[model samples]
Target: MRKVIVNNIVSLDGCYADATGNPLALNMDAAFDQANLDSISAADVVLLGRDSFDGFSSYWPFIADAPEPDDPDAPEARALSEVNRAISRRYNAIPKVVVSDRGGVPSDNAWAQTTTVVPRGAAASWVADAKRNGDGDIVIFGSRRMWNGLLGDGLIDELHLMVSPTVLGDGVRLFGVPADLDRIECRRYDGSPNVQLRYRVLAPRSDRAS
Candidate 1:
């Protein structure tokens, strides 16, 4: 079966919410941006929680052509425009599995073409089915709640974390495990401004002994 990877940007204190008072500034790390785009490029489907979807829907679409925060003709502005365009196209084209309890249909637009709202309890099975359908690895982004649920159920195969330097006293934590995580193999990448950590889930001790 294809792997289900969870990719998220987190603060040193583990908060995933808006840290700089601006929602767009949540997990604002250049390294994380590049890494997230790379993950999206590799995955066949992107999974998101309802809350994350709402946030992304409002931000990513219009940002592409929006006026630059700084100089419009500057290199940074051009780069932002290009990245936003790429993000918009990729998000619109890739299949999206949104986990929600609402049981309603996605909106009638590009969101409809690529989006499906799976019931909360059925998310793991739906994700497994998608992976078994010959789709490449499914990448789940944002949605700390979803991450916690999937992690607890042992549905997540790998975790790609972009650890930022800043810290928030309290906010949305990415890892909300109640018990200790089973054995994990971690590989660290020296991605400056933000460190990248890749963890492969290992079999539980009891399973390994058998």
Candidate 2:
């Protein structure tokens, strides 16, 4: 069975969204970008929430081909453009499972491919089935709502959190449930501007019958 890994870029306050209701603001850092690309490269499939898929489908394809407007001639611009192209290419080629109430995704990009749109009620079961049927890692990026649901269900195997330096007073949080996640272990990285935290879910304890 494949492991479902949840990765996100969050603020100090746990807000995944910015004031403008856009989640990209939390992903502006270079470290976050690198981490996400690396994870995507290693994963067998990428899962997205409906809103996150909408945002990504709108931006990635176009941005992947377009160079940076401010510094088109800069080395950073070239590097970023290359990275975006590779990432976009992979996203287009990879199998994606989108969880949405609607049956189909509305996208005009040639690279846009929606494999299966499991109904809202069946998402949890479908995800579990996917995990049980596949190998390697299935990554979940974006979609805090979906993530929180999976977390609450205790379906997540590992968590890769990119903690940014900035703080948003009010916005979307990563974990909204009252469940205790204190059992998860975290490994912090050094020499990185953004803090990278990896957490593995621990097993629950149950009293045995004599």
Candidate 3:
């Protein structure tokens, strides 16, 4: 079966975004570009919630190429630019699935050819069918509610929380329900001011409403 991975970058206070729905709204030094690149690279199918898909489809498609670094001598800037380019390529090419209660995506969408929107009512069945039909991993980047429901349905295989060291006093917190998970790994990046907590779901609340 294709493994389903749900990944999110959160603040020190456990919030995924500020009240305005912007992850960097509060000037939080969320410099985890490499992590984002890694996620996109490992995904064969990118799963996103309606809001996340909206935000991503609006922005990521525009990241076709990175701007030249202001200072050519600045390796860090140049490296970041390359990362952006790589993420753009993968994110745009990989097949995408959006779990939304809404109807469907417009045909003019840049990702329309590679995107599929599953109604909220059919998400579980769709995911199960996708898993059965493939061996590649289905990765969800920041669909908290979607992942939450999938977790309760015992569909999620792994949960990765990339925690940044910032405290946004008020935002949409990540955890709203209890889960049964086993620790996979908790590691701090060597040169980055972020840490990742990985977990594998041991048991899911199948009784929880989807």
Top-scoring candidate (TM-score): 3
> Model 2, residue 168: displacement in angstroms?
1.7
Model 1, poorest ten-residue lDDT window? 201-210
The candidate that wins on lDDT is 3
Output the better candidate (2/3) by TM-score: 3
What are the runs in model 3 whose C-alpha is more than 4 Å off? 25-31, 66-80, 205-210
What does the lDDT read for residue 25 in candidate 2?
A: 68
lDDT values, one for every candidate = 0.70, 0.72, 0.80
lDDT of 1: 0.70
* Candidate 2 TM-score to native: 0.82
Ranking by TM-score: 3, 2, 1
Summarize candidate 1's per-residue lDDT along 1-210 as a digit string, tens digits: 888888887777767665453333454545566777888889988889998887777666665566556777664664475555677678877888889996654464447666888899898788767667765888988887886777766677888877777777766556666423433544344546667777776532332311
Q: Which stretches of candidate 1 lie over 4 Å from their true place?
A: 18-27, 64-70, 73-79, 106-109, 178-192, 203-210
Q: Candidate 2 clashing pairs?
A: none
Q: Is candidate 1 or candidate 3 better by lDDT?
A: 3
**Per-candidate TM vs. native?**
0.79, 0.82, 0.86
lDDT of 2 by residue, 55-124 (tens): 7777666656665569677645644555667777777777888889965865564435645577778888
